[model samples]
Target chain A: MGGDFGPQVTVPASVQALLQYPELKVILFGDQSAITSQLSLLNQLQHPRLSIVHCEHVIANETRPSQALRSSQGTSMRMALDSVSDGQADACVSAGNTGALMALSRYTLKQLPGVDRPALVTAIPTNTDNKTWLLDLGANVSCDADTLFQFAVMGAVLAEQENSASPRVALLNIGEEEIKGNDLVKRCAEMLANSPDINYIGYLEGNELYSGRADVIVCDGFVGNVSLKTSEGVANLFIDSIKNAISTNPLKRLVAKWLFNDLFISLKQLNPDQYNGASLLGLRGIVVKSHGSADVAAFSNAIGEAVHEVKRQIPTKISDRLEEVLLERHY
Target chain B: MGGDFGPQVTVPASVQALLQYPELKVILFGDQSAITSQLSLLNQLQHPRLSIVHCEHVIANETRPSQALRSSQGTSMRMALDSVSDGQADACVSAGNTGALMALSRYTLKQLPGVDRPALVTAIPTNTDNKTWLLDLGANVSCDADTLFQFAVMGAVLAEQENSASPRVALLNIGEEEIKGNDLVKRCAEMLANSPDINYIGYLEGNELYSGRADVIVCDGFVGNVSLKTSEGVANLFIDSIKNAISTNPLKRLVAKWLFNDLFISLKQLNPDQYNGASLLGLRGIVVKSHGSADVAAFSNAIGEAVHEVKRQIPTKISDRLEEVLLERHY
Candidate 1:
């Protein structure tokens, strides 16, 4: 009843997740008939550790955030978030409408203290073996100096956990000079440089995102989202262009049979679907937003990310770091 | 002296440009002896149309904009710009420091009235036969709604002149919806929609930049620079990864010879060098900034672009449009 393919993909992905994690339990919240039909098709209707809470209302993709919050109490997306808030579930994952999902999760769990709005952070693969975590994917379009500073702190905490070390952070800017960015970015850079709690690498240009100059790159949601989407667009153009070129003639097509073998293996390594889940940071509970167009394998990866976040206690760690910074300021 | 290769590339490139346009005359601005030696090597030293201006001062890449404006009067970069300002040359092209060039040009010629600062706009090849022009490459970091609207008008004029038709202008944002961007971007969109001169298509996402949906895309310099640089980084990464994969095996390497034939052709067509010159729009005189690491061919393309701008009378047309816009507002 949600996402592009709804239970068709999520149900199979859940079964796959259950296979991977033996101790896992799943409570699906969607139309009973839709869930039953799929479960019965796979003969998983009587599977142990799986339950369905019949939910009639579905949050459509076109539903506005305000409308969803006003009348989506019984919606699957809302119930899933509520399950996490009420301690019935350890974490929640959804491929529903992003705006509605964010609104409902914030409305249900409320933002953590000292956080105005949660930012979306996702891992983008770089030329280096590791990936860079970019925050505010499309959360807050325009941010003040303080809000940007807060994103740095939150992003640093997440990157530390994600990288299993103290992450080197840099403000995303046009140039690497102290005078390159606007006043807001310059102010944020100065504050981060003076702070002693994190590794604050001054400024990183967009060309440096995949050049592996920083572990965490922070910017306002508008720039972050545009950069991320533009990267994807170029990548698609590259691959599609190659495919069309290979298909242009029989000789190239013959070569593509083997050429595509290793080409795809490398391409698969950089697939956006392989890194589908984006964490809604600064929220009180864990909520992972899977790309709406994600398929079974991609949705499975999102579920895995949710499981990993729950185990890592990422929110708790961020809370502690925030408190430490706040108490230091008070002192 | 400023770019990576400097006169070694520039001198040969100037010779190549002169060969293409026989009526073209060049004034070499740098050390007289170095220019003489390079010209002799190409048998271009005594060419009647080629003249050498002995200028010992060279602008270093590391020079700050303020320092360049205050003390770089005698430097080659500044002299080249002066030639254009005095109407001795049709236009100026340089592979020098971008910040310094922008500063020196603005200070020497003065900005057009009603223009705060000029923006860096470059043509990017798209899937379609035509190219898209993205502005504020790394010039102004933060722009108000009025500034953004100005970019649209400037970009629209440039695109119309470049494409010989009214170009579709768009505001680059995270989403295509009207509610997608910040307050500033939203307000700018509204003004563009109401404007009757250009074809305003409203909001466009970053993914659509290379999709050839719009002819001119506008954004704050920070986002524009990042998007441009990020696209370059990804394109490089895509090619490099495929090269590594193909080189891993002998069979793949053999196929790559023939396999890479059309692939390289398509890539070369999309090469940034082929579209090298970035126009510094909103200035009284025409100036083009070439990539610092550009080769002889790329530098030649930049020079060609400058000549084209001079012939097209782009700056005069933009000035007229600005006056028209101002008069409309006055009424």
Candidate 2:
């Protein structure tokens, strides 16, 4: 009972995930009636791998994170987190309010031993086949140099998991020069440069973000969030402009039937649905947050991401790596 | 002597502007020989409105802003700005390094009264016919609440000149709420809301940037620069993906010959060239900064923007409006 669509979208997505992964088991936490109605509609009311926990309350998207934290008992988001905390579930996925989810996850799951704060990390589609892992995507609005250094480690760990190698880490700054950004960014850059264990590739400008120059790009949440959202906005504008171009011309419309099908095939790499889930890293338990407005395919992608993290033991890897890095620095 | 193409791009652009505006006089401040060669190629070397001032130095793009200011006496960028300050020219336009240009502009033409620092403001192409004015695009790395509030006023002033109305000014943040954003942003939002002189909208997310929701959007330079560049990156990615799609199908290419022309015709409003110039506002004189990689048409657009600002007396307007608004609040 989260996100804009509530059970209508999540139920089908859960069913899809169950079908995709033979060993996957899903626990749906929401109002039993709403969950059952959708389950019955899809004839999955009694699926063997699927279970339902009747949740009494749901968190509204408008609720303040601070307020949500105090009164989160029995809420679907909290109960789901509790299930993870109690070791019943390997990971939890939600499409609820971002701030509330972050707050609840941080409070309930707690931070890893060497981690200062949990960061929201997501893979952004690049111009090439490879995806760039961008971190601190609205998890913390502002971060100090130490926190940013920690984020770089976490981001590189995630990228290493995906790429199966020493990932190239780059600091997101206004300019590539050593003297370009604010003191906070400069200090963070210095820390990354001094770290021998990390493959720090110096600074990257925002324009080169999708150039596939770095495996992991790190920045504070404010800049990362704005950059991520701004990319989406530009993509939307381009799509709208193209669609308008196709619609306005009658001849183009006739050609678009064949052309658009091929175009979508080529443009599939740039689709947002495939990159739906943004995992909250640095926490003890895995929590993958889906977009609030995710559709069925998008929500299914989030579930897949949680499944991937569970198998990879991402939280454990992050904890071990952070400890190793901190120990190497004699911290 | 500035930008990628230097006189190769600027000379033709100056000739175009002189042709477009008969009253406009252009002083070319660079190597006199290089300026004459380009002017002679265009056969505008002896044009009545065209003149050249030989400059002894050029600032490399890699030069730090601090170092650029120290030796900027006879540099092309500085000379052009000095012309504006000495009343030889009403406005200055450059496609030099952004940091160098900002430092020189601030040093040569002092800030307006009541303005803490100058901000870079530019019009972004929107989904509708109207454009959005975004400010503080890499002028200052970070800004306080008072500086952001002043940016809002300056941005609105520029937007009003374009729209001829009370432009709706919105603060760019991760979310739209009283509680959202960092302390500085929240405090600035309060300032905008409290001021009766500003038509302040609540807040704008990055995804709504091109939706034309607000005429003027304000943010600190760091966030603003990243957002602006991120949008460009996304646009480039989209164009590349579409071009790749078009190239893969030979039959589609034949259809694209006609369809592409029509498509470009419809997509003209979204073109970057028309919106190339980013003005440095809240200064004692008008200074327009062109894209460093700008072509002739794009450079001409920057000159056109400078001409418009000169005619409107944008700096004077900003100073007067800022004083009036500041006086009203007893600041």
Candidate 3:
């Protein structure tokens, strides 16, 4: 059992994923009875492509990483990651605690060679009808310059998989000037600029995030997390403003009811459901973390992302590319 | 002399402020000829309440803080701040380089007693029709726990001047849990919890920023700046999305042209011009930094903010309150 709705949402989402991808096999690592009950409701209890492994413990959303790591022997999150590490599963997806997920994934699956830390990477929608990759989203709260540089390397390798030969890597800073940012960001900039493998852009401020100026934006976990969350907050405020505008008058409300459907269709690119999954990058095994409050459709999107990553062999490519870049730079 | 349009924007803004506030007097520091030319255009060249102090040097926006500090003897930004220090002006407002302004203000006006560093504080509009104060917006990139605690103290004091005796102060972080954030934020949280003067409300994530759950949010300049700019980016993206939606079809364009005015009026609170001023808090004298690209209306708003801070005697109140709190906590 995991996430807010546990098996009720996860089982349905997994069933949807199984229906969508004919060759995809899913292994549910949670309470067998709970999974069976939900699968039974969907008439998928004995689906040929689906299996279940009963987990004795479940990680709470509030559990600290350290606490979860200590008693994570038979937990659902631990067993799922174990399936990937043991070569039984191609990838693992979970709508559970992010901190515990990262901690357990690091402990069970381990980091890729030359990767000091695993960063949480996600695709953020931009105004240019494309997405930019943002990394270190609360994986490591504080990162040294060397750690940040490694994140840029991993981020660039990940972005290159999206069809760009050499992704423009940028350090997320307060200003675009050469003299802006602290010692950590400045040093990281220097490292990225000198690396021949990375197409290092000088700096990108937060306002330029949605301009699609860079393919990969890297920063310490704290700044990345705040920027992502702040975007959500502003989006919510804007949506609320629209709702209030339509509700204040009867005529406007009627007009909105007539035209809102088309408006939403036009703005479909801004949908959060499509961007639900965040991959734990730099790990040896693929682990996709879904939003805790995700619904069936959103969780299904997370499963789709994991399948995509597995098909692309993201982890292997990141490992090989990082090694080549490091060996060349003598880093 | 300073900012993008220099005296062209600031002069007309000064005239506007003189018109709005009959008892107010404005001292403009820039090229005398440029200031007079703009005032002459508005037919206020002989205005008694307005005076101009010509400065030979000007600081470019690209200048670093350290570089600006070295050669800022007779620059427009430095002279404006010096007027406040010498009691020639009650407060100062500039639409110039943020870093240079911060350095020169700290050098001329100096920090209030018990204050380690002055912070850039601004009012962000929330959905509740009230604004929340956010501080350390790119003032100090990397802050220790003690410095962050001082920002909270100064933030609370500033918020109190806005008619709230006990403003709920919150530390901005990635998560709302006690175990979240870096060591600096954690240590600052502990200090805030034990202090009797502050109304500490624990951690606040970025998504909760606009929910009005906290009246004042404190963080290091790096995170605060990123959050603020990210919000602006999101807002711009949403606006662009709406524009794209309306322009995609002829019928929608016609409808938008008819109703967009009313919709914009309803969303007037989201306008950036009204929130153009960001005060440099914890300083002995009031110094409001306007957006560099601000027009006349936006620059006038900055002057209005300075007058409000002067009337409230924010600096003296902040200095006194911080001393009382520090003394009570034996800090």
Candidate 4:
């Protein structure tokens, strides 16, 4: 994983991965000694499935992804992506710089057919039986009507695979009303409504998403990023607030104990790390982007998700669906 | 107070005002009987301060404030704002259309000097000891460098008045590094860093807002709106998740009871309603905009806040500060 604090966290994570999945093979892509030092601390050592691919060069936290990738050929993050592109690995995962990861993947691997831009897609648990999938969480800031429509298509496909059944897609607007958003959302609504490939359920306000309105929500990168981050901040805020309320006064603490189950379920649903990495949709290969602050458990979960995506052949399914949509478009 | 749903929520809220502050005067601007009926339900009969102006007209939800005011004269929200402008009331509060409120307020009340656009400022409770004031939360979608700089100044002033002494203002960027954001954020950073009006603390990444980086966080409307909503969504998600987790198995629920105080405090810290209603800064009068879903408690708290703003003469203070900043700009 491409993280700021490298193998310090990844080493324990790799060991945890082995424990979770017996058949899993983990190839560490960082400084050899750093990886070795971390792995040596683990109780289980010298597992055949665990291997290290050392790329001595490191991408400093301050370095821009584009500049780093252009200047350093041996950066661990770049090498990991290269391994995926060159078929040395089935998929790649990272918890390092998000912008750098996006820039590197877009520049190196390139976009898939009919995919104008690759979006960061994550599954958010909803009140419904199935979770909701949201896209363009932080990949592209500016987007047009057509791009959003494409996001709906991609998000729907991802949701179908992840949550089962045909996922209903909705455009994330300021309001549920078609006429209630800025110019971008209005045009996007029109385009998504016209598109036949998506199971478009029309527009949903930001607040309605948590109310379990739809299975897939699509928006431009700016809005999606804010929504995703806002959700994280609010979740953290809620957890913090609850803790303070219950602990600050003695009486409330007793009440809190009785309502503990109710509160825990609520707080856990909002942790971004629990959901882990978002899938880089509309890419030729299955790539997952984890949060920069992701710990060992989060990274391992991302890897597990990556494995699931690869096994599911999500890319192939998306390609086939896009081709069908394109054929229908010509008609 | 510019919200999607007004009168229905506001009328009841106005009645609840009496309970919170017994000496408060409430002049209902909508149809006299409509508001009276709501007040009557609370068993408040013939209170000297509770009065209503007969106005049958309303600004439609879709109508822009400029258009609504030009075309319609008797809108309840418009009349309420007129009460503030004409000095009929100490402050104006609304849960009606936000765009309409902004448009009407800007047109009727006018902006303070050196203020290009009046921002919607609100205080969200963070994990830190002090609450953070975020401005331009949803006022203007697109803003220039100058506009953003003004927002920072006004946000800081608001933060200070809200009890944050020597408030530190931070420009909201994608990353915390000096060079790590889009062109707009970069330009804003330079302006904020150079500005004498605000206690500029440099940049804050989206994820770090909750981590207590700064007291006042400033951004354009698009980013601010998304961030605010996303925070709300995430809060809800966390509450739901924690509830599910605690109840997932009987054993976890038992443990959850013991940790209830910690959990509840954290969740309460993120309650959006507690921070409901953003002030329209840079305006002639104190205009507070509460959320459409604001409950009786939120409404009561908003009324309390309006009283505080009126007592502090926030508008005059902001005006004086703006003059000081502008004069410094000339020198």
Top model number, DockQ: 1
lDDT of each: 0.83, 0.88, 0.86, 0.75
lDDT of 4 at A168: 83
TM-score of chain B of each: 0.96, 0.97, 0.96, 0.90
How does each model score on TM-score?
0.97, 0.98, 0.96, 0.86
Best by TM-score: 2
* Model 3 C-alpha lDDT per residue in residues B75-121, reported as the tens digit of each score: 89889888899998989899999888888899999999998989999
Candidate 3 lDDT at B257 equals 65
List the candidates ranked by lDDT, beginning with the highest.
2, 3, 1, 4
* Better-scoring candidate (lDDT), 3 or 4: 3
Q: Quick one: how many clashes does candidate 3 have?
A: 0
Q: Write the per-residue lDDT of candidate 4 for residues B1-331, one digit (tens) a residue.
A: 2344455567667777766777688887776776667667767657777787878887666776567668757777778888898999988887767788888888778898788999988988877777788878777877888898888888878788765678899877654232255567778888767766678998776676776778899888877776776667666656656676667678667756666646565566566656876899999998888776677667767777787788889888888888887778778
Q: What DockQ number belongs to candidate 3?
A: 0.60
lDDT of model 2, residue A128: 71
User: Which numbered prediction scores highest in lDDT against the true structure?
Assistant: 2
Residue A230 shift from truth in candidate 4, angstroms: 2.5
- Where does candidate 4 chain B have its weakest 10-residue lDDT segment? B173-182
Q: What share of the true interface contacts does each candidate keep?
A: 0.62, 0.57, 0.56, 0.38
- The order by descending DockQ is 1, 2, 3, 4
Per-model clash counts, in order, read: 0, 0, 0, 52
lDDT (tens digit, per residue) of candidate 4 on A32-85? 987787777874458788888889786666777668668658888888888888
